[model samples]
Target: MEHAIIIVVILTGLGAVFGLILAYANKKLALEVNPLIHVVEDVLPKGQCGACGFAGCMAYAEAVVTRPEVAPNLCIPGKDPVAKMVAELTGKAAEAVEPRIAQVRCAGSNEKATRGFKYAGVSDCVAANLMFGGDKTCKYGCLGLGTCASNCPFDAISMSEAGLPVIDPEKCTGCGKCETVCPKKVIAMMPLTARVRVNCNSRDKGQVARKACSSACIACTLCVRECPYQAVKVENNLAVVDPSVCVANNCTDAKCLAKCPTKAIRPAVLGIVPGAEDQAAVERACPSCIKTNTAAG
Candidate 1:
Protein backbone atom coordinates (compact mmCIF):
# COMPACT_ATOMS: atom_id res chain seq x y z
CA MET A 1 0.00 0.00 0.00
CA GLU A 2 2.85 2.40 0.93
CA HIS A 3 4.75 1.55 -2.31
CA ALA A 4 1.60 2.15 -4.40
CA ILE A 5 1.10 5.52 -2.65
CA ILE A 6 4.79 6.42 -3.33
CA ILE A 7 4.46 5.42 -7.02
CA VAL A 8 1.34 7.60 -7.42
CA VAL A 9 3.08 10.59 -5.79
CA ILE A 10 6.17 10.15 -8.02
CA LEU A 11 4.05 9.94 -11.16
CA THR A 12 2.11 13.04 -10.11
CA GLY A 13 5.42 14.90 -9.49
CA LEU A 14 6.78 13.88 -12.91
CA GLY A 15 3.55 14.94 -14.64
CA ALA A 16 3.69 18.32 -12.82
CA VAL A 17 7.33 18.81 -13.90
CA PHE A 18 6.49 17.96 -17.55
CA GLY A 19 3.51 20.33 -17.53
CA LEU A 20 5.69 23.14 -16.15
CA ILE A 21 8.35 22.49 -18.81
CA LEU A 22 5.72 22.52 -21.59
CA ALA A 23 4.25 25.76 -20.27
CA TYR A 24 7.68 27.42 -20.20
CA ALA A 25 8.50 26.17 -23.75
CA ASN A 26 5.18 27.38 -25.02
CA LYS A 27 5.77 30.86 -23.58
CA LYS A 28 9.30 31.04 -25.03
CA LEU A 29 8.69 29.52 -28.47
CA ALA A 30 5.30 31.00 -29.27
CA LEU A 31 5.42 33.25 -32.37
CA GLU A 32 3.98 36.67 -31.70
CA VAL A 33 1.03 37.36 -33.98
CA ASN A 34 0.75 41.01 -34.88
CA PRO A 35 -2.45 42.51 -33.42
CA LEU A 36 -2.74 44.44 -36.69
CA ILE A 37 -3.77 41.22 -38.46
CA HIS A 38 -6.99 41.04 -36.42
CA VAL A 39 -7.56 44.74 -36.98
CA VAL A 40 -7.16 44.30 -40.75
CA GLU A 41 -9.37 41.21 -40.76
CA ASP A 42 -12.08 43.12 -38.89
CA VAL A 43 -12.02 45.75 -41.65
CA LEU A 44 -12.53 43.08 -44.31
CA PRO A 45 -16.00 42.09 -45.52
CA LYS A 46 -15.40 38.63 -43.97
CA GLY A 47 -16.91 36.97 -47.02
CA GLN A 48 -13.88 34.62 -47.28
CA CYS A 49 -14.69 34.55 -50.99
CA GLY A 50 -10.96 34.33 -51.94
CA ALA A 51 -11.35 37.17 -54.44
CA CYS A 52 -8.13 38.57 -53.00
CA GLY A 53 -6.29 35.41 -54.12
CA PHE A 54 -5.79 34.28 -50.53
CA ALA A 55 -7.42 31.38 -48.71
CA GLY A 56 -9.59 33.58 -46.51
CA CYS A 57 -9.98 37.02 -45.00
CA MET A 58 -7.76 36.22 -42.01
CA ALA A 59 -4.99 34.92 -44.27
CA TYR A 60 -5.21 38.03 -46.44
CA ALA A 61 -5.15 40.19 -43.36
CA GLU A 62 -2.01 38.46 -42.15
CA ALA A 63 -0.37 38.73 -45.56
CA VAL A 64 -1.12 42.43 -45.94
CA VAL A 65 0.07 43.14 -42.40
CA THR A 66 3.19 40.98 -42.46
CA ARG A 67 4.25 41.15 -46.10
CA PRO A 68 5.30 44.54 -47.39
CA GLU A 69 5.05 43.32 -50.99
CA VAL A 70 1.39 42.36 -50.75
CA ALA A 71 -0.96 44.98 -52.17
CA PRO A 72 -3.63 46.34 -49.79
CA ASN A 73 -6.35 46.86 -52.41
CA LEU A 74 -6.78 43.19 -53.27
CA CYS A 75 -10.13 42.77 -51.49
CA ILE A 76 -12.58 43.16 -54.35
CA PRO A 77 -15.89 42.89 -52.49
CA GLY A 78 -15.14 45.86 -50.26
CA LYS A 79 -14.44 48.11 -53.29
CA ASP A 80 -12.80 51.46 -52.76
CA PRO A 81 -13.96 51.88 -49.17
CA VAL A 82 -12.18 48.77 -47.99
CA ALA A 83 -9.15 49.42 -50.19
CA LYS A 84 -8.64 52.84 -48.68
CA MET A 85 -9.02 51.47 -45.15
CA VAL A 86 -6.53 48.69 -45.79
CA ALA A 87 -4.05 51.02 -47.49
CA GLU A 88 -4.17 53.40 -44.52
CA LEU A 89 -3.65 50.57 -42.05
CA THR A 90 -0.79 49.01 -43.96
CA GLY A 91 0.76 52.34 -45.05
CA LYS A 92 0.73 51.10 -48.65
CA ALA A 93 -0.16 53.03 -51.78
CA ALA A 94 -3.83 52.52 -52.63
CA GLU A 95 -4.63 51.93 -56.25
CA ALA A 96 -8.16 52.68 -57.37
CA VAL A 97 -9.99 49.37 -57.75
CA GLU A 98 -11.90 49.20 -60.98
CA PRO A 99 -15.50 48.32 -60.13
CA ARG A 100 -16.62 45.12 -61.82
CA ILE A 101 -19.66 42.84 -61.93
CA ALA A 102 -20.39 39.22 -62.83
CA GLN A 103 -21.94 38.68 -66.26
CA VAL A 104 -23.54 35.46 -67.52
CA ARG A 105 -22.19 35.11 -71.07
CA CYS A 106 -24.90 32.73 -72.23
CA ALA A 107 -28.36 34.03 -73.15
CA GLY A 108 -29.62 30.46 -73.57
CA SER A 109 -32.85 30.30 -71.63
CA ASN A 110 -35.04 27.18 -71.33
CA GLU A 111 -37.24 28.38 -74.19
CA LYS A 112 -34.33 29.31 -76.45
CA ALA A 113 -31.80 26.51 -75.84
CA THR A 114 -32.63 23.10 -77.35
CA ARG A 115 -32.44 20.35 -74.71
CA GLY A 116 -30.68 17.14 -75.70
CA PHE A 117 -32.07 15.15 -72.77
CA LYS A 118 -33.80 15.69 -69.45
CA TYR A 119 -31.44 15.71 -66.46
CA ALA A 120 -32.94 13.55 -63.69
CA GLY A 121 -29.95 13.01 -61.47
CA VAL A 122 -28.17 15.53 -59.21
CA SER A 123 -29.12 19.21 -59.49
CA ASP A 124 -25.47 20.32 -59.42
CA CYS A 125 -23.92 21.64 -62.65
CA VAL A 126 -20.69 19.65 -62.25
CA ALA A 127 -22.65 16.46 -61.64
CA ALA A 128 -25.00 17.15 -64.54
CA ASN A 129 -22.06 17.99 -66.82
CA LEU A 130 -20.46 14.59 -66.12
CA MET A 131 -23.40 12.92 -67.91
CA PHE A 132 -22.82 13.91 -71.54
CA GLY A 133 -22.12 17.61 -70.86
CA GLY A 134 -25.50 18.43 -69.30
CA ASP A 135 -29.01 18.39 -70.78
CA LYS A 136 -28.54 21.48 -72.96
CA THR A 137 -27.62 20.95 -76.58
CA CYS A 138 -25.23 23.87 -76.33
CA LYS A 139 -22.30 22.23 -74.52
CA TYR A 140 -20.70 25.62 -73.79
CA GLY A 141 -23.82 27.23 -72.38
CA CYS A 142 -24.87 27.55 -68.75
CA LEU A 143 -26.35 24.35 -67.26
CA GLY A 144 -29.11 26.41 -65.51
CA LEU A 145 -28.90 24.05 -62.53
CA GLY A 146 -28.32 26.94 -60.07
CA THR A 147 -24.79 25.76 -59.25
CA CYS A 148 -23.42 29.28 -59.69
CA ALA A 149 -26.35 30.82 -57.86
CA SER A 150 -26.05 28.43 -54.93
CA ASN A 151 -22.29 28.95 -54.58
CA CYS A 152 -22.47 32.76 -54.70
CA PRO A 153 -21.80 34.05 -51.20
CA PHE A 154 -23.32 37.51 -51.81
CA ASP A 155 -26.71 36.18 -53.03
CA ALA A 156 -25.97 38.18 -56.18
CA ILE A 157 -27.15 35.36 -58.45
CA SER A 158 -30.65 33.92 -58.62
CA MET A 159 -32.18 31.41 -61.03
CA SER A 160 -34.63 33.12 -63.36
CA GLU A 161 -38.04 31.62 -64.06
CA ALA A 162 -36.65 30.79 -67.52
CA GLY A 163 -34.16 28.32 -65.92
CA LEU A 164 -31.29 30.78 -66.33
CA PRO A 165 -29.24 32.50 -63.64
CA VAL A 166 -29.77 36.28 -63.32
CA ILE A 167 -27.02 38.32 -61.74
CA ASP A 168 -27.96 41.31 -59.61
CA PRO A 169 -25.37 43.97 -60.46
CA GLU A 170 -25.99 45.97 -57.31
CA LYS A 171 -25.35 43.01 -55.06
CA CYS A 172 -22.49 41.45 -57.07
CA THR A 173 -19.17 42.52 -55.63
CA GLY A 174 -17.28 40.83 -58.49
CA CYS A 175 -15.82 38.36 -56.04
CA GLY A 176 -16.02 35.77 -58.86
CA LYS A 177 -17.60 33.01 -56.76
CA CYS A 178 -20.24 32.50 -59.45
CA GLU A 179 -17.62 32.63 -62.19
CA THR A 180 -15.51 30.03 -60.39
CA VAL A 181 -18.39 27.60 -59.80
CA CYS A 182 -19.84 27.66 -63.34
CA PRO A 183 -18.92 24.35 -64.96
CA LYS A 184 -19.25 25.77 -68.47
CA LYS A 185 -17.46 29.00 -67.51
CA VAL A 186 -20.41 30.98 -68.81
CA ILE A 187 -20.16 33.42 -65.94
CA ALA A 188 -17.53 36.17 -66.46
CA MET A 189 -16.38 39.21 -64.53
CA MET A 190 -16.53 42.48 -66.47
CA PRO A 191 -15.67 46.07 -65.80
CA LEU A 192 -18.65 48.04 -64.51
CA THR A 193 -18.03 50.70 -67.13
CA ALA A 194 -18.16 48.23 -70.01
CA ARG A 195 -20.87 49.36 -72.45
CA VAL A 196 -21.34 46.24 -74.56
CA ARG A 197 -20.62 42.47 -74.50
CA VAL A 198 -21.06 39.38 -76.66
CA ASN A 199 -23.51 37.26 -74.65
CA CYS A 200 -22.68 33.94 -76.30
CA ASN A 201 -19.94 31.49 -75.30
CA SER A 202 -20.48 28.79 -77.97
CA ARG A 203 -17.48 27.96 -80.15
CA ASP A 204 -19.47 25.70 -82.46
CA LYS A 205 -19.90 26.54 -86.13
CA GLY A 206 -22.56 29.11 -87.11
CA GLN A 207 -25.28 26.62 -88.05
CA VAL A 208 -24.54 24.26 -85.17
CA ALA A 209 -24.56 27.14 -82.66
CA ARG A 210 -27.89 28.47 -83.99
CA LYS A 211 -29.37 24.96 -83.81
CA ALA A 212 -28.31 24.57 -80.18
CA CYS A 213 -29.60 27.95 -79.06
CA SER A 214 -31.63 30.41 -81.15
CA SER A 215 -29.87 33.28 -79.34
CA ALA A 216 -26.34 31.90 -79.88
CA CYS A 217 -23.69 33.94 -81.69
CA ILE A 218 -23.31 32.55 -85.21
CA ALA A 219 -20.00 34.37 -85.83
CA CYS A 220 -21.72 36.21 -88.69
CA THR A 221 -18.92 38.84 -88.39
CA LEU A 222 -21.57 41.54 -88.85
CA CYS A 223 -20.62 42.94 -85.44
CA VAL A 224 -16.94 43.02 -86.46
CA ARG A 225 -17.72 44.94 -89.65
CA GLU A 226 -20.27 47.26 -88.02
CA CYS A 227 -18.03 48.27 -85.12
CA PRO A 228 -16.66 51.67 -86.22
CA TYR A 229 -13.78 51.48 -83.74
CA GLN A 230 -12.81 47.92 -84.75
CA ALA A 231 -13.53 46.79 -81.20
CA VAL A 232 -15.45 43.66 -82.18
CA LYS A 233 -13.85 40.55 -83.67
CA VAL A 234 -15.05 37.07 -84.56
CA GLU A 235 -12.82 34.45 -82.95
CA ASN A 236 -13.49 30.71 -82.60
CA ASN A 237 -17.07 31.03 -83.91
CA LEU A 238 -17.83 33.73 -81.32
CA ALA A 239 -17.89 37.52 -81.43
CA VAL A 240 -15.65 39.16 -78.81
CA VAL A 241 -15.65 42.86 -77.91
CA ASP A 242 -12.71 44.76 -76.51
CA PRO A 243 -14.39 47.20 -74.12
CA SER A 244 -11.13 49.03 -73.54
CA VAL A 245 -10.82 49.89 -77.23
CA CYS A 246 -14.46 50.95 -77.34
CA VAL A 247 -13.93 53.22 -74.34
CA ALA A 248 -10.72 54.66 -75.74
CA ASN A 249 -12.37 55.42 -79.09
CA ASN A 250 -15.54 56.74 -77.37
CA CYS A 251 -17.61 54.43 -79.59
CA THR A 252 -21.02 54.73 -77.97
CA ASP A 253 -22.89 54.02 -81.25
CA ALA A 254 -22.90 50.25 -80.63
CA LYS A 255 -23.80 49.84 -84.30
CA CYS A 256 -22.87 46.19 -83.78
CA LEU A 257 -26.00 45.76 -81.65
CA ALA A 258 -28.21 46.55 -84.67
CA LYS A 259 -26.13 44.46 -87.06
CA CYS A 260 -25.96 41.20 -85.08
CA PRO A 261 -28.33 38.74 -86.78
CA THR A 262 -28.90 36.62 -83.66
CA LYS A 263 -28.52 39.53 -81.18
CA ALA A 264 -25.65 37.70 -79.49
CA ILE A 265 -23.67 40.91 -79.06
CA ARG A 266 -25.71 43.10 -76.68
CA PRO A 267 -25.50 46.18 -74.51
CA ALA A 268 -23.74 45.10 -71.29
CA VAL A 269 -25.69 47.76 -69.36
CA LEU A 270 -28.81 45.63 -69.54
CA GLY A 271 -28.61 43.37 -66.48
CA ILE A 272 -28.73 39.66 -67.50
CA VAL A 273 -32.38 39.56 -68.53
CA PRO A 274 -33.04 36.53 -70.78
CA GLY A 275 -35.17 38.26 -73.42
CA ALA A 276 -33.47 40.34 -76.13
CA GLU A 277 -36.66 42.10 -77.33
CA ASP A 278 -36.63 44.60 -74.47
CA GLN A 279 -32.90 45.18 -74.90
CA ALA A 280 -33.43 45.84 -78.61
CA ALA A 281 -36.04 48.47 -77.86
CA VAL A 282 -33.78 50.16 -75.27
CA GLU A 283 -30.85 50.17 -77.70
CA ARG A 284 -32.98 51.78 -80.40
CA ALA A 285 -33.89 54.64 -78.08
CA CYS A 286 -30.35 55.44 -76.96
CA PRO A 287 -28.65 58.66 -78.21
CA SER A 288 -26.18 56.60 -80.19
CA CYS A 289 -28.98 54.88 -82.05
CA ILE A 290 -30.61 58.17 -82.94
CA LYS A 291 -27.31 59.58 -84.16
CA THR A 292 -26.58 56.44 -86.22
CA ASN A 293 -30.03 56.58 -87.84
CA THR A 294 -29.66 60.32 -88.55
CA ALA A 295 -26.23 59.79 -90.15
CA ALA A 296 -27.50 56.86 -92.24
CA GLY A 297 -30.60 58.73 -93.31
Candidate 2:
Protein backbone atom coordinates (compact mmCIF):
# COMPACT_ATOMS: atom_id res chain seq x y z
CA MET A 1 0.00 0.00 0.00
CA GLU A 2 2.85 2.38 0.74
CA HIS A 3 4.51 1.60 -2.58
CA ALA A 4 1.20 2.10 -4.44
CA ILE A 5 0.71 5.50 -2.74
CA ILE A 6 4.21 6.56 -3.74
CA ILE A 7 3.57 5.60 -7.41
CA VAL A 8 0.27 7.50 -7.47
CA VAL A 9 1.93 10.62 -6.01
CA ILE A 10 4.64 10.52 -8.71
CA LEU A 11 2.12 10.25 -11.50
CA THR A 12 0.05 13.14 -10.12
CA GLY A 13 3.11 15.35 -9.73
CA LEU A 14 4.22 14.75 -13.35
CA GLY A 15 0.75 15.53 -14.70
CA ALA A 16 0.62 18.80 -12.76
CA VAL A 17 4.03 19.88 -14.01
CA PHE A 18 3.13 19.12 -17.64
CA GLY A 19 -0.17 20.96 -17.30
CA LEU A 20 1.58 24.07 -15.96
CA ILE A 21 4.12 24.02 -18.82
CA LEU A 22 1.40 23.63 -21.47
CA ALA A 23 -0.61 26.43 -19.90
CA TYR A 24 2.36 28.77 -19.86
CA ALA A 25 3.29 28.00 -23.45
CA ASN A 26 -0.27 28.47 -24.62
CA LYS A 27 -0.43 31.84 -22.92
CA LYS A 28 2.92 32.94 -24.35
CA LEU A 29 2.28 31.95 -27.98
CA ALA A 30 -1.45 31.95 -28.37
CA LEU A 31 -2.78 32.43 -31.94
CA GLU A 32 -6.30 33.65 -32.38
CA VAL A 33 -8.27 32.94 -35.56
CA ASN A 34 -8.53 35.88 -37.94
CA PRO A 35 -12.16 36.62 -38.79
CA LEU A 36 -10.99 38.06 -42.12
CA ILE A 37 -9.56 34.67 -43.07
CA HIS A 38 -13.00 33.20 -42.80
CA VAL A 39 -14.35 36.05 -44.85
CA VAL A 40 -11.76 35.51 -47.59
CA GLU A 41 -12.19 31.75 -47.63
CA ASP A 42 -15.93 32.09 -47.87
CA VAL A 43 -15.60 34.04 -51.14
CA LEU A 44 -13.27 31.48 -52.75
CA PRO A 45 -14.21 28.48 -54.83
CA LYS A 46 -13.65 25.37 -52.69
CA GLY A 47 -11.93 23.39 -55.51
CA GLN A 48 -8.58 23.47 -53.61
CA CYS A 49 -6.83 22.78 -56.93
CA GLY A 50 -3.79 24.88 -55.97
CA ALA A 51 -4.25 26.85 -59.21
CA CYS A 52 -3.55 30.04 -57.30
CA GLY A 53 -0.11 28.72 -56.25
CA PHE A 54 -1.35 27.80 -52.79
CA ALA A 55 -1.58 24.36 -51.25
CA GLY A 56 -5.27 24.86 -50.53
CA CYS A 57 -7.98 27.45 -49.96
CA MET A 58 -7.15 27.98 -46.30
CA ALA A 59 -3.48 28.56 -47.04
CA TYR A 60 -4.44 31.09 -49.71
CA ALA A 61 -6.75 32.75 -47.22
CA GLU A 62 -3.98 33.21 -44.63
CA ALA A 63 -1.65 34.63 -47.24
CA VAL A 64 -4.25 37.04 -48.60
CA VAL A 65 -4.98 38.27 -45.09
CA THR A 66 -1.30 39.00 -44.56
CA ARG A 67 -0.83 40.68 -47.97
CA PRO A 68 -3.76 42.75 -49.13
CA GLU A 69 -2.24 43.24 -52.61
CA VAL A 70 -2.37 39.50 -53.10
CA ALA A 71 -6.00 40.06 -54.09
CA PRO A 72 -8.33 37.84 -52.09
CA ASN A 73 -10.21 36.95 -55.28
CA LEU A 74 -7.34 36.07 -57.63
CA CYS A 75 -8.69 32.54 -57.86
CA ILE A 76 -9.12 31.91 -61.59
CA PRO A 77 -11.62 29.13 -61.22
CA GLY A 78 -13.71 31.53 -59.12
CA LYS A 79 -13.89 34.09 -62.04
CA ASP A 80 -13.98 37.91 -62.02
CA PRO A 81 -17.45 38.12 -60.50
CA VAL A 82 -16.27 36.30 -57.41
CA ALA A 83 -13.21 38.55 -57.28
CA LYS A 84 -15.42 41.61 -57.35
CA MET A 85 -17.38 40.20 -54.44
CA VAL A 86 -14.18 39.70 -52.41
CA ALA A 87 -13.00 43.21 -53.16
CA GLU A 88 -16.31 44.68 -52.05
CA LEU A 89 -16.30 42.85 -48.71
CA THR A 90 -12.67 43.73 -48.05
CA GLY A 91 -13.23 47.40 -48.94
CA LYS A 92 -10.36 47.39 -51.48
CA ALA A 93 -10.11 48.57 -55.06
CA ALA A 94 -12.07 46.25 -57.35
CA GLU A 95 -9.89 47.06 -60.30
CA ALA A 96 -11.69 44.90 -62.82
CA VAL A 97 -9.79 41.63 -63.07
CA GLU A 98 -9.20 41.02 -66.77
CA PRO A 99 -10.72 37.61 -67.37
CA ARG A 100 -8.11 35.17 -68.67
CA ILE A 101 -8.42 31.87 -70.54
CA ALA A 102 -6.12 28.97 -71.35
CA GLN A 103 -4.50 28.80 -74.78
CA VAL A 104 -2.73 25.81 -76.36
CA ARG A 105 0.48 27.06 -77.93
CA CYS A 106 1.00 23.94 -79.99
CA ALA A 107 -0.70 23.71 -83.39
CA GLY A 108 0.48 20.22 -84.28
CA SER A 109 -2.72 18.29 -84.05
CA ASN A 110 -2.29 14.79 -85.55
CA GLU A 111 -3.49 15.95 -88.93
CA LYS A 112 -1.00 18.80 -88.94
CA ALA A 113 2.00 16.77 -87.78
CA THR A 114 2.95 13.18 -88.45
CA ARG A 115 3.63 10.79 -85.58
CA GLY A 116 7.11 9.29 -85.42
CA PHE A 117 5.73 6.22 -83.64
CA LYS A 118 2.84 5.11 -81.50
CA TYR A 119 3.25 5.80 -77.81
CA ALA A 120 2.41 2.70 -75.75
CA GLY A 121 3.90 3.79 -72.44
CA VAL A 122 2.27 5.33 -69.36
CA SER A 123 -0.82 7.47 -69.99
CA ASP A 124 0.60 10.60 -68.38
CA CYS A 125 2.07 13.22 -70.79
CA VAL A 126 4.89 14.03 -68.40
CA ALA A 127 5.82 10.35 -68.36
CA ALA A 128 5.76 10.05 -72.14
CA ASN A 129 7.80 13.26 -72.43
CA LEU A 130 10.70 11.51 -70.61
CA MET A 131 10.98 8.89 -73.35
CA PHE A 132 12.04 10.26 -76.76
CA GLY A 133 10.86 13.77 -75.76
CA GLY A 134 7.40 12.81 -77.10
CA ASP A 135 5.79 10.69 -79.79
CA LYS A 136 5.45 13.55 -82.27
CA THR A 137 7.84 14.86 -84.90
CA CYS A 138 7.71 18.30 -83.25
CA LYS A 139 10.25 18.21 -80.43
CA TYR A 140 8.47 20.93 -78.42
CA GLY A 141 4.84 19.98 -79.05
CA CYS A 142 2.25 19.18 -76.38
CA LEU A 143 2.60 15.64 -74.94
CA GLY A 144 -1.20 15.19 -74.68
CA LEU A 145 -0.97 13.14 -71.46
CA GLY A 146 -4.11 14.90 -70.11
CA THR A 147 -2.24 16.39 -67.16
CA CYS A 148 -4.14 19.60 -67.74
CA ALA A 149 -7.49 17.85 -67.83
CA SER A 150 -6.79 15.80 -64.73
CA ASN A 151 -5.54 18.78 -62.74
CA CYS A 152 -8.61 20.81 -63.55
CA PRO A 153 -10.81 20.39 -60.48
CA PHE A 154 -13.56 22.30 -62.28
CA ASP A 155 -13.80 19.70 -65.09
CA ALA A 156 -13.39 22.58 -67.53
CA ILE A 157 -11.03 20.59 -69.75
CA SER A 158 -11.62 17.61 -72.03
CA MET A 159 -9.13 15.83 -74.29
CA SER A 160 -10.47 16.48 -77.75
CA GLU A 161 -11.50 13.29 -79.52
CA ALA A 162 -8.08 13.76 -81.18
CA GLY A 163 -6.16 13.62 -77.84
CA LEU A 164 -5.48 17.40 -77.55
CA PRO A 165 -6.84 19.04 -74.43
CA VAL A 166 -9.73 21.41 -75.23
CA ILE A 167 -10.57 23.89 -72.49
CA ASP A 168 -14.12 25.14 -72.39
CA PRO A 169 -13.76 28.90 -72.10
CA GLU A 170 -16.94 28.96 -70.06
CA LYS A 171 -15.57 26.42 -67.62
CA CYS A 172 -11.91 27.53 -67.35
CA THR A 173 -11.02 29.67 -64.32
CA GLY A 174 -7.58 30.86 -65.57
CA CYS A 175 -6.03 29.35 -62.43
CA GLY A 176 -2.78 28.80 -64.40
CA LYS A 177 -2.67 25.16 -63.26
CA CYS A 178 -2.59 23.89 -66.83
CA GLU A 179 0.18 26.33 -67.67
CA THR A 180 2.15 25.16 -64.63
CA VAL A 181 1.78 21.44 -65.41
CA CYS A 182 2.50 21.50 -69.16
CA PRO A 183 5.90 19.84 -69.53
CA LYS A 184 6.32 21.37 -72.98
CA LYS A 185 4.99 24.75 -71.77
CA VAL A 186 2.36 24.80 -74.53
CA ILE A 187 -0.45 25.88 -72.25
CA ALA A 188 -0.76 29.61 -71.49
CA MET A 189 -3.19 32.14 -70.10
CA MET A 190 -4.64 34.60 -72.64
CA PRO A 191 -6.95 37.41 -71.78
CA LEU A 192 -10.56 36.35 -72.27
CA THR A 193 -11.36 39.71 -73.81
CA ALA A 194 -8.47 39.59 -76.25
CA ARG A 195 -9.72 38.84 -79.78
CA VAL A 196 -6.71 37.38 -81.62
CA ARG A 197 -4.10 34.85 -80.50
CA VAL A 198 -1.25 32.99 -82.17
CA ASN A 199 -2.37 29.35 -81.88
CA CYS A 200 1.18 27.99 -82.24
CA ASN A 201 4.29 27.70 -80.01
CA SER A 202 6.91 26.44 -82.47
CA ARG A 203 10.07 28.52 -82.02
CA ASP A 204 11.85 26.79 -84.90
CA LYS A 205 12.76 28.66 -88.07
CA GLY A 206 10.00 28.84 -90.66
CA GLN A 207 11.39 26.05 -92.84
CA VAL A 208 11.97 23.76 -89.87
CA ALA A 209 8.66 24.59 -88.20
CA ARG A 210 6.97 23.88 -91.53
CA LYS A 211 8.49 20.37 -91.67
CA ALA A 212 7.61 19.44 -88.06
CA CYS A 213 4.00 20.62 -88.02
CA SER A 214 1.82 21.90 -90.84
CA SER A 215 0.25 24.59 -88.64
CA ALA A 216 3.44 25.69 -86.85
CA CYS A 217 4.23 29.40 -87.04
CA ILE A 218 7.21 30.05 -89.33
CA ALA A 219 7.80 33.62 -88.02
CA CYS A 220 7.43 34.97 -91.56
CA THR A 221 6.45 38.36 -90.05
CA LEU A 222 3.53 38.70 -92.45
CA CYS A 223 1.28 39.26 -89.46
CA VAL A 224 3.77 41.71 -87.97
CA ARG A 225 4.14 43.65 -91.21
CA GLU A 226 0.41 43.61 -91.84
CA CYS A 227 -0.64 44.98 -88.46
CA PRO A 228 -1.26 48.68 -89.05
CA TYR A 229 -0.62 49.18 -85.34
CA GLN A 230 2.69 47.21 -85.49
CA ALA A 231 1.39 45.12 -82.58
CA VAL A 232 3.13 41.97 -83.83
CA LYS A 233 6.87 41.33 -83.58
CA VAL A 234 9.02 38.34 -84.51
CA GLU A 235 10.92 37.26 -81.40
CA ASN A 236 13.15 34.20 -81.05
CA ASN A 237 11.75 32.71 -84.24
CA LEU A 238 8.25 33.21 -82.88
CA ALA A 239 5.64 35.75 -83.93
CA VAL A 240 4.40 37.21 -80.64
CA VAL A 241 1.11 39.08 -80.41
CA ASP A 242 1.18 41.98 -77.96
CA PRO A 243 -2.35 41.90 -76.52
CA SER A 244 -1.96 45.46 -75.31
CA VAL A 245 -1.15 46.65 -78.83
CA CYS A 246 -3.42 44.18 -80.65
CA VAL A 247 -6.36 46.08 -82.15
CA ALA A 248 -9.33 43.89 -83.07
CA ASN A 249 -9.50 42.69 -86.73
CA ASN A 250 -6.96 45.39 -87.54
CA CYS A 251 -4.17 43.00 -86.52
CA THR A 252 -4.88 41.16 -89.78
CA ASP A 253 -4.46 43.36 -92.82
CA ALA A 254 -6.12 42.23 -96.04
CA LYS A 255 -2.96 40.43 -97.17
CA CYS A 256 -1.48 38.97 -93.94
CA LEU A 257 -3.75 35.98 -93.15
CA ALA A 258 -3.67 34.98 -96.82
CA LYS A 259 0.14 35.23 -96.77
CA CYS A 260 0.55 32.64 -93.99
CA PRO A 261 2.26 29.59 -95.52
CA THR A 262 1.04 27.24 -92.79
CA LYS A 263 -2.26 28.99 -91.92
CA ALA A 264 -1.01 29.00 -88.32
CA ILE A 265 -2.32 32.43 -87.30
CA ARG A 266 -6.00 32.35 -86.42
CA PRO A 267 -8.66 34.85 -85.37
CA ALA A 268 -9.62 33.99 -81.80
CA VAL A 269 -13.19 33.39 -82.95
CA LEU A 270 -12.15 31.75 -86.19
CA GLY A 271 -15.35 30.47 -87.64
CA ILE A 272 -14.91 26.80 -88.39
CA VAL A 273 -14.02 26.35 -92.05
CA PRO A 274 -17.40 25.98 -93.64
CA GLY A 275 -18.36 22.28 -93.52
CA ALA A 276 -15.45 21.43 -91.19
CA GLU A 277 -16.85 18.80 -88.87
CA ASP A 278 -16.63 19.33 -85.12
CA GLN A 279 -16.66 15.53 -85.05
CA ALA A 280 -13.10 15.27 -86.41
CA ALA A 281 -11.30 12.25 -84.95
CA VAL A 282 -9.63 12.98 -81.61
CA GLU A 283 -6.06 11.76 -81.09
CA ARG A 284 -4.83 10.31 -77.79
CA ALA A 285 -1.70 12.48 -77.86
CA CYS A 286 -1.55 16.20 -78.50
CA PRO A 287 1.02 15.88 -81.23
CA SER A 288 -0.47 12.76 -82.80
CA CYS A 289 -3.91 14.30 -83.16
CA ILE A 290 -4.30 14.13 -86.92
CA LYS A 291 -7.68 14.98 -88.36
CA THR A 292 -9.81 11.98 -89.30
CA ASN A 293 -9.29 13.22 -92.84
CA THR A 294 -5.65 12.22 -92.49
CA ALA A 295 -6.63 8.60 -91.93
CA ALA A 296 -8.82 8.88 -95.02
CA GLY A 297 -5.90 10.26 -97.02
Question: Best candidate, lDDT-wise?
Answer: 1
Q: Residue 213 deviation, candidate 1, in Å?
A: 0.5
lDDT of 2: 0.71
Which ranges in model 1 have alpha carbons more than 4 Å from their true place?
Answer: 1-21, 276-281, 284-297
Clash pairs, candidate 1, are: none
> Candidate 2, after superposition: displacement of residue 78 in Å?
2.9
The C-alpha RMSD in Å for every predicted model, in order, reads 3.3, 7.1
Best by TM-score: 1
Model 1 Cα lDDT, one tens digit per residue, 98-172: 999998898899889999999999989999999999999999998988999888888888898888888887789
Regions more than 4 Å wrong, model 2: 1-30, 248-255, 270-297
> Deviation in angstroms for 230 in model 2?
0.8
TM-score of model 1 vs. true structure: 0.89
- Report the C-alpha lDDT of model 2 over 1-297, residue by residue, as the tens digit: 999999999999999999999999999999998898899888888888787678989898778777767875667677777778777767666556677778877667767776788999999888989889889877878777789889887787887645577878777878888888888898888886554567678778888888888888888888777666766788988878777665454333323343456656555542222112232211211112244235656
- Kindly state the number of residue pairs that clash in model 1: 0
